[model samples]
Target: MAESEHSSSENASMDSIEEHSKQDSELEFSDDEETLIIRMFNLVGERWSLIAGRIPGRTAEEIEKYWNTRYSTSQ
Candidate 1:
């Protein structure tokens, strides 16, 4: 039905928006940034907002996620 098709289209648009929002929140790290995060993590012990402030251009939530994904287990 046309209504069903319209609803599906709306769902697809919403999905695309969600995906874009997730991508926007993801921050890319340079080698220096990675080193800084590791060092700060050692110094502060998962105090991500402080570490993020030291790194520049990254949110605390993003830094926490990145550290958890990439480095948490190693330390």
Candidate 2:
């Protein structure tokens, strides 16, 4: 009984981790979202939270990272 309970818990933990990874992967922005982000950046400057608000399911940090990777110049 104890071993079965432990196994169940481990399976649940693995499932939870896999679900989290799936959600993270699903967060990738589409082309329309990227265009919106660019337009929002023009309108709101670096207020990433505001930009994210316009784009559903996106967090400020994610939007900022995308902006930096796609738009910022390397120095």
Q: Superposing all C-alpha atoms, what RMSD in Å does each candidate have to the true structure?
A: 3.6, 3.5
Best by lDDT: 2
Estimate, for each residue in 1-75, the C-alpha lDDT of model 2 and write its tens digit: 999999999999999999989866755789999999989899889999999899888899989887887789985
Relative to the true structure, how large is the alpha-carbon lDDT of every model? 0.85, 0.88
Q: Once all C-alphas are superposed, what RMSD does model 2 give against the true structure?
A: 3.5
TM-score of every model? 0.68, 0.63
lDDT accuracy of residue 31 in candidate 2 = 90
